[model samples]
Target: MATVGAGRDAGQNLCGCCDDVVGGLPTGSDLDLLREGLYGCFGGAFARELVVLSPGSIVLAGNHTDHQGGHAVACAVGSYARGIFRANGEGRIRVGGRGLPAIQLDSADLDARDGGLDDLSAMVRGMVALFLQRGLAPGDALGFDAYLALDEPVGSGLLGESALELAFAQGLNNLWAGGTLSGEELALAALRVARERLGGSSAPMWQLPVALGGIQHLSFADSGGAVAERIDFDFAQEGYNVCLVEVGDGRVTEPASCSSILQEMQAVAGALGAERLGDVREVDFMMDLPVIRDQFGDRAALRAIHFWREDRMVEHRVRALKAKDMHAFLELTRASGASTAMYLQGTPRVARSQAIMLGLAVADENLRHEGAACIHGGSPERAILAFVPDSVYELFSQGMNAIYGEGACRAYEVVDEGASAWWL
Candidate 1:
């Protein structure tokens, strides 16, 4: 554990220039814990203090279509990653997290490749660089310090890296830009940062639910970027409990593991004379099925089949949510799962395991026809999402627990709010 405090105490390491304070505290319900961590690292003379937060989210629909310019439904989960911020006069921006050493950089000059580009430090540098490039920098004489933490984390938390990315970006906007940058702007900037560092994994709304908040229907159909519309519905009104059923700790991401699926889908799209399956006409695909099967092989054809059906299914599911028809939404979700199993998983890949399949079978015994279960976070699946009606939430939870063990199922509410900043 990283200790918080001042004056070179053993094991209570002070991150870059930290001194004159006493100790550190773990994250909890309030900003007090983050406040202490900030004071311990950068001193407490700063009057301007802000808290920025974004929740973890789940991809509700559009399984294999994120990169193909297709539409999807997503919602913010109950878990959140938050940051406490304050301005420091030294022109040195610093960021620290619970149980981790702080990373500091000069505000006047920023570098994307500096300091392990794959980690959170890169994100901090990217935020500073973005503000500076946009002519939105507060000033050369000012800098900021943020203490980041996860509150009530479930499994890996909903946002993962994007959660921290959104929090830090928004904090910078509020502290330095006079809160001028909108939530959409911050989300786009984070997407840009991720693209530069990691090659654009979840564009066009790189974790928009976290940055923008609420249950949303997102479309990547526009080439310019993502389009998100607020979805208004009371999930609890229907008495359905949305939960994530832990499958197992997913394996270390091999670059080729997840990409392989996208590549396979791409091959089929190419056979149809289009860049992505979304752009291909259904008639064109059906007419060219023989060519696709003969040229790209059966696996590619099958994945393309999954993509087309899923592309349409996502919009249908979104409509179900908009219509407030829980039965329709649940039915669509099950159909999506069946389609992925039959078409997308045509070839055996060790990294993409069947644990999720087994978990779904267990959920079926309890859900019967009233609830639904499917892979939670898309490929390299680690958790299964189960929608249980409130009347049977207990039975559903207990049944999942029996198979996956106790505490495997965690209830999550779709938070209506998105990312925002407040002074304390």
Candidate 2:
């Protein structure tokens, strides 16, 4: 048998655009590291026979609005949660990766994960169990050993968890089911795992972009997060780069703190007899604010107002992108950011970081010229999403890292693919 990690061709050419999407082709050494890591985890069997999956997204517009079935513009970034898998034939599943301990569980015991649930293990088990419940298997008749590695940080609200869920979900499907699931199905399935098992805050907003891939204008209906209109969008032709600046102070923001944004929005929607804020017209919402105020108070009224305006901003931004008008899009993004800060008031945890990001957007010529930056969304996030003219991208990166520290900024190229898997 070939030694572990001996053959590198297994994952090569799996993603045709990996080089272009991953900031130019990875060097031989980079590929070597990937292979070496695979070998180190599972030896020759897993290294020689494996599958790879990538997660993709950067919300260009619409923040904390998708759960309300609102419009959102999402771009697919190159970063991935690569899951390498091979059938174990032992009816047990094993998972391992960087910063994650090797986890092994009998196929019969996956449901037992809840008793002493380690968050990550429960997540993996939950994902697998979800698939099985849907009458799908993660591999052939045999179970599998999987290894996951992410190029992005967890809990930055950059869709890292969503990416992991999609990558694993799709990878398992491809391995066991011959990739029969459609893109829409895979995306929805992953969202279900996040919502049902992980108790995630946002699913459709994050899952759709990551699962569907590419630059998309996702118009979610006022209904409860099921219906969506997907349209193609392009920003590269206009020489713009999407940069996600991780301003995290080395801590993951808790979901409990950010949960109130959606909860309050939902409460307002319920009071308005609407499923989501989007169902209430701007004029109607304003006219009804007094009635809403009496019950939910001004805080809820203001948050609901932000939702209405945020949806409008997303609609306008989508039009701007479609018209190839980058200027108007940036303006709308700035307005949306301001509204988030002032009206929504859901970013208390990252308020200081938000201030620092807004300051950079206004003061730094490199960032300010033909670019706009914001706190990413109304939900508490440690990162800011900035759209910079390609000409100033490098300078913008330098400026951000100088302030936020090196490795804080990442420039993502929107790609045309999503949650795909391949077998070797």
In order of listing, the candidates' clash counts read: 5, 0
Best lDDT among the predictions, by candidate number:
1
Residue lDDT tens for model 2, 42-135: 6655333455656567777887778787878775678877666777677877788765667777777776344221256777777778778877
lDDT for 133 (candidate 2): 80
Q: What TM-score does candidate 2 reach? A: 0.85
The residue pairs in collision within model 2 are: none
Cα error of candidate 1 at position 48, Å: 1.5
Model 2 has how many clashing residue pairs?
Answer: 0
Indicate the residue-level lDDT of 263 in model 1: 85
